[model samples]
Structures are given as structure tokens and as C-alpha cells.
Target: MFALLFSITIEAKEIEEVVVVGAYVAEDIAEPTEDNILETIQPTKTFMLGGFNGIQLSGTDTKHTGVFKNGVPVNDPSSGWYDFGHDLSTGQKVTVITGANSVRFGSGSMAGVVLLEDNFGRSLFTQIAEDETKAMVEYDYFQIAYYKGTQGSVKSTNTENDWYENKTFKAGYDIFNIELIDYYYEYDTCYDSNFAVSDDCSVEGEKLNVSIDHDRFTLGYTNNKSTHNTGYDMESDRTYADITLVDMLGHELGISGQKETYGERERETYSAYYIWSNDNVSVGYRYEEDEHIVRLGLENDGLRFSVGNSYRLPNLYEQFGDSWVSANPDLLPEQGYGAEIGNDWVSLYYYEFSEGIDFDMNSYSYVNTGSYISKGIRFQNEISLDKGSLFVYSEFTDSDKLRVPDYRTKVSYKYLGFNVEYLGEFDKGADFDGREIDDVNTFNISFSWYPDFATEIKIEVEDLLDNKYEFIPDYNSGGRRLKLSFNTIL
Candidate 1:
């Protein structure tokens, strides 16, 4: 995103290096959060729900993608969807693996995998938007973060405000070839009845994790629990244990398991993987939920190629959990295959899903109805100019399935200390079943100023032209919005 890029520039030569605050994303479901941050960060790769509560790969649904922290999944174990964090700032190194390369996690990665790892330094950061403010402080191997947001809907019949609060704590210590990390997060959100799980009710969640790393392997344990105010006594206690054996001359192995007691029902899962890699090539295999997949990849002289299978197992939320829409327990698992070949400048790929799961606006529930074949190409290039520079990136995808677009293009220009970008999405000139979606375009500008060696101040404007179009039916991607960000080395 422009905000992140500007921040990176300031961080490179100004302040002492600090982790980019890339934490939680959603502010309030009653009022969808940033299209500004999430969209810009991976515009062509992701599809959003009109800048609202849902986002996933361009051709995949939320349930098909997974979010992991330090190699453990952070997605709600019950929903199987990554609903909360789309794009907030954090002090972590974020790595995204998609297409055939996603076999690293085996199942439940129909689209991709997002991995987050601790990468912090002594620093302070804060960003403020129209309805929210987030701040964080870090020192050595410790971190504390807080966020608050409030929203009021414009719908006359549902004119009420929703609020959200979040807090995070992390600490780590290393000695004698052994490392220990402790992390905790607390989330609370209350929304109006119309768009809430329960009218004017609160949903709270808590997580704590302890991990130990040794010369040969890593052992981790997590106690995750959350309570949803759905007009009922809804709460669950979940536990996870994992061990990973590091590479000893190109050999690696991993095993993980989870168990959760949800009211009268119980959920459990077990998965593992084995991989072998040297300097320029890697091969791996994963098994989960009675399904197995193999992946292969290689790179040399700025060229890359990969091939593998993708799969996912449905979770309770997709089948029976209640939310803004009804649940469908009849949903089936997803299976697919994909391959890609390209280099640094351009790439071509293909993927086909025999059975893909997704949220169907027509049925108002989850469905295995997005299956189809897709082919695509990507191009990225940069040109230097007399004053600044110009960067161009574009992708065109053709899918036999509905609910997906065929083209996306992004052009950005940097002049002096200011950055401007333009994004355009075009719907395929075809027909489909559910809600009729339309094309959407957005423009943005950002500027950063370093007042001192240890500090930076940046301003950004999203949807600069106030263009309103429908990427999702009946939802209005709001008008222009502004954000101010500041960070300093402690």
C-alpha cells in the first residue's frame, strides 16, 4: 500500500529499523474497514467484499485461505475463514504463498497461505483514520499494541453505532540454543442487531501461546478460546500442539494437531508435511483430512516454475455457525490443481477447481459452487523518468466461472516525495447467477515527511476522486478518506 511504501522509505535511511506494524485489519463489521490498505497491498491478487468484512484470493473464498502466526493458524478454528485481519499494521514479517506453492500447508489452502513471524525492534508507531486509531510500542523482544474503532451506519432504519477494541502482548527470550515466546491477544466488538450476530451484543476472544525452539526442532502449545454473543451461551476452548523438525542437510518435517470442545460438539484435525530442498530447487508433500498433495518448484537465472495440488476442509462456521447470513452444513470439501511459470517481469499460470467452496449471495449461505477453470498472465515493470519514476503492474485472468473479473491494472508515479496510484477492475463481458457485480476503480495519493532522524509523518488519501461503484451489490464503497501515520525509533 502507499502508506506502507512511504513508511518503508522513511524507515530505510531515517530511523533505526523497526518492524512494520502489520497487525489486525477489520475495524467494525457493521462498517467495513480499509479497502485502502488491503486493496493496495495486493490489489490484483485479492478480492474484497465491497471493502467490507470478507476478503480472499481473486478466485477463492475466505474459507479457502488460511492465516498463520509463527507457523500456527490464526484463523478462527471454527469458521475456517480469516475474517479479522486483512491489513492492519504489525511488527512481523509477512509471507504469502499462493497457487501451486501453497502445498506447504497441505489442506485448507485452496487459495493461499499467509504467514506471520515476529520481527520487531525498539520503536513506536501510530496511525489514525476517520473512525479508528492504532498504536504500538516495541523494545528488544517485547511488544504491546492497542486499537479502537467506532462506526455509525448511514441506513436510516439502522442508525446505530458499533465499536471495537483490541489489545496484544508479546515477549520472547533466547538462551542456550533454546528460544521461548509468549503471545496474547484480546478482542471485543459490539454491533447493532441489524448487522450483528446479536442485536447490540458483544463478541469477545482471547488467545495465548507458548513456543520453544531447540537446535533440532520447535515445540508449541496454544490455548485459544472465544465467546460470541449470538443470543445464546456460545463459547469454546481449543488447544493445539505442534512440532517441526528443521532441515538437516535438505530434509524437514512437521506435525500439528488441534482439538476444540464447542458446546456439545467437538472438532479435531491433524496435518503434517515433509520437504527437501537444496540451493535452487524444492519438493514437498503434505497430508491432511485423508487427502494428500505434492508440490515442486525451482528457480534459476530469474526464471521460476512450480506445480502442485490445492485442497480445503470445511469448518463449522461455513456449515452451521450463524452470522449475517444463514449457514449450510451441506457444503463439501474443495479440491484443485494449479501450475505457474514465469520470472521477475511476467508470469503465466493455470488453475482448475473441480469443487470449490464459496459464499453464495444468491442462496445467502456457503456453497460449493465456484468451481471452474482459469488462466492468467501477470506483467510488472518500472521505468525511470527525468524527475521521478513510473511503475506499471497488470494482470488478466479468464475464468469459466462467475463471480470473478478478468482484468486488473495498476499504474503508479512517484514525483519528488509524493506517490500517486490508479487502479482499475473490469468485469468479464458475460453473465452469471447471483448478485450482479459491477466494475470499480480507485485513485490514491500519499506523501511522507521526515521531520527528524528518529521520526516520520505521512498523509494518505484513498478514493481521491470519490468514485462510487459496486464491486459488491448494494454496498457503496465510501467516498474519499484520509489517514495520518507517525512512527519513531525509541
Candidate 2:
């Protein structure tokens, strides 16, 4: 799974390297350091599709990926998919990890993990209590951003608008912390009325999240509900609690648990886990869905290796649903084991580069539609220059049925106050309905400008070439589209 860390401190440097995943990091806080995350998240990948930034590992569909907001799994319980459509205005840094699973996760992370963290709590209060030695009453962070997207093709029938806002209030008590996030989004599609179809189809949704931490323990909750004009609506709620402990040997220990309610059926499910870690070794065990998961890892200097086996519970739709022809409730949970080893390379224009390979064998992969063994090799490189910086990422995966890009790449350049980035993917065709589909190649480009340290305006264009091919049958590409967003701190 992926992890996101929000840092408010900016290293003292001249040419700060900037990287943007789902959230953007400026030069002020982009310099790498012993304690900074600049080097760890050097190469960032994000996709802007429809109304939100899609996951690179899941293609256009987000269900193939698992997402966690502040260590709590947020995928829809009924579908086990995350839209990634919510506004990240409350966050400062967003990280996505691929090809590895950590003790922090339970199920639904076969593809990878998406992490969203924020500094709204620390930055908002730490500033008011600026006196390094005292706590003050001044504390709060609020932001509002508007997003609009329009289809570029004249024949297009898609449009989107979103209004998002967040507020964080702290009392500077240091003993307790609470933060809340609220988001509302809506999108519309036009259908041919002549064919007895609804002229306009719209979907509206809202999400509310609350997190409270006291001392060494934290409790979090998320409620997400949505409605559709086509009579398909759903709601998912999740609650999680976790605590940290330190043993006599100075090793850290963590215990956490989660419970979720799926659909109106109200079927409840839960999971629990405990993990312990020292300087160079870590071990964890978790229980969920009548399955046991064990994880082991070791790290020394710049070399690291890890191996783990976990199971994914079948989503609500997979067990009992009328949308599909044959929804089987007896389907078994998907289980798999993964292993990886890598080393960081220093002393080059590329501050940090890592070459690693992993293998995952699944007994019953829900997304892949069956059992299969997949092997993947990952490569990451980043270069910092005087005027700008360059980052590169490539991965090769060998699998059957599941359609994943054979290779992908991203490029970024920052000069003066403007940033330009591009991401592209190359995927081989997968057989469907007794026919060999054509290979699909897609690319997206984004241009953003920072008027100041706290404000940014961005314009992004997806599917620049307007490729009409679809990864799945009947799922027509939305062609070329434009999205404009304005964000700032208040």
C-alpha cells in the first residue's frame, strides 16, 4: 500500500525540486534531506480523467486500486473502488505506492495503495504557537476551490462542476486534535433523447470525514453517500481506531482495527492487526475475512526487502447484485503473496534511483477475473538541474486477462514560476469476446502556474490525441477534455 506524509517545513535551498502526485509540492518544500520526503517520493504519477485525478495503476477505472485517507481504507464497501474525486485542498502532500504491501493495510490493495495526508492540523496551530516554546490560541486553516471541466470535442456529451471546502480547528491543547473535511461534487451526461433515453443524466455526491487523536491513539470516521438519476445510489461508512506503543527495546508497536457498513443492507465487516518494528526488522500479523496475513521485512542502509501474503474480501456488488448477469455469493476471497528488493543510488544528477522487481501470485484475483501469477519490475529516476528537474518511471508486468500498461513514463519541468508535466502509457491489447482488441496508447499534459507560495492556477488536458479506443468494450473514451482549477490557502 501507499503512504502519504504532509510536511510544512521547507528545506533551505536555492533550486527546490517540485513533484506533483494528486497534490502539488513547490520548490520551497521540495528539497531532499535526511528527514524530508523529497527523495522518497521523487517520481510522482497522477491521472486527470472525467472529474478527478485517476490512479495510474488502475487505468481509467479506480476500482483496480485501493485508497486510504489517513491510514483508513476509503474504498466503497459495496464495490471496493475509490473514485479519487474528492478535493485535496486540505492536504499538502499526496503519495502513491505500487508493487508492495505494508502492515498498515488489510484487504483491497492488490493493485497498490493511495495515501492522502495533510498538515492542516500541525501547520494551522504550529504557526499560531510560533514561539517554539509555548502554545497559543490562534489556530485554524480553511480553503475553498472551484473546478470546471468541458469536453473539447464538439460531439462530446460530458460536463463537470465541483465545489469543495475544508476547515480545521485546533485549541493548542496538545493533548487532543480533531479535523474535519467536507466535499460536494456533481457531473452530467447527455444522452440521445430520440432513442427513448433520458436527455440528461446527472450524479451528485458528498463526503464527510472526522478524525480525532488523543495522545498516542487516534480514531477516525468517514461517511460517503451518493445518488444517480438512473436509480443507482449507494452509501458507505467506515470507522477506524489505532494506537502506538514503544517496547522496552526501543522498538515501536502499533495495533489497529476497523469496521465498515456496506449498502443499505447494513452487513457489517471488520479487521484487526498488530505490527512491531525496530531499526532494521519488522513483523506484522492481521486477521480479516476468515483469513490470516503475515508480513516480514528488513532494511539496512539503502537496501531493503519485504514479503507478505494477504486476502481481499469480495465487495458487496460481487457477492449480491443485480447489475451483472451472474453475481456469485460463494466466491472466495483473493489471496496473494509478494516480495521485492531494491537499493537507492546516490552521487548523480538523479539524486535517488532505485531498481526493483516483485512477484505476486493470486489464487482468486477479483479484478483479473481469475487466478493468475504476475511478475513486475519497477524503475524510478529523478534528476535535479539548475533551471528545472526531470523524473522518469517505468514498469514491466507479465500477466494474463488483466490489462495493464506494459510500460509508462512521466516528465516534469519547472522554470521560473511555471510547471509543465506529461504522462503517457502503452498497453498491449487483451482478448475480448473472441476478438483481439487493438493496443491503446494514451497521454495527458498539465500546465500549472504559481502566482505565489500559497496560490496556484492549473489547466490540464487529458487524452491529447483524442484516441477513441477503450480499455473495455462499450466504454467509449471521453475524447479530449479540459480542466481548470484554482487553489490557495486562507
- Pick the lDDT winner: 1
lDDT of 1 by residue, 310-364 (tens): 7776766667756555868678887888777777667777778888666677777
lDDT of 2 at 23: 15
Location of the lowest summed lDDT over 10 successive residues in candidate 2:
346-355
Candidate 1 least-lDDT 10 residues: 11-20
Compared with the true structure, what per-residue lDDT tens digits does model 2 show for residues 302-412? 666666664666666666553322345666666556555665421100000111111123322233244445555666656889877766665555544344566555566
Instruction: Evaluate model 1: give its lDDT.
Output: 0.59
What is model 2's C-alpha RMSD?
10.7
After the best TM-score superposition of candidate 1, give how far the Cα of residue 373 lies from its true spot, in angstroms: 2.5
> Where does model 2 exceed 4 Å of error?
1-66, 88-91, 97-101, 107-111, 121-139, 152-199, 244-255, 267-272, 322-327, 345-368, 418-420, 431-490
Task: Give the true-structure RMSD of model 1.
Answer: 8.6
CA RMSD per model (angstroms): 8.6, 10.7
What TM-score does structure 2 among the candidates reach? 0.67
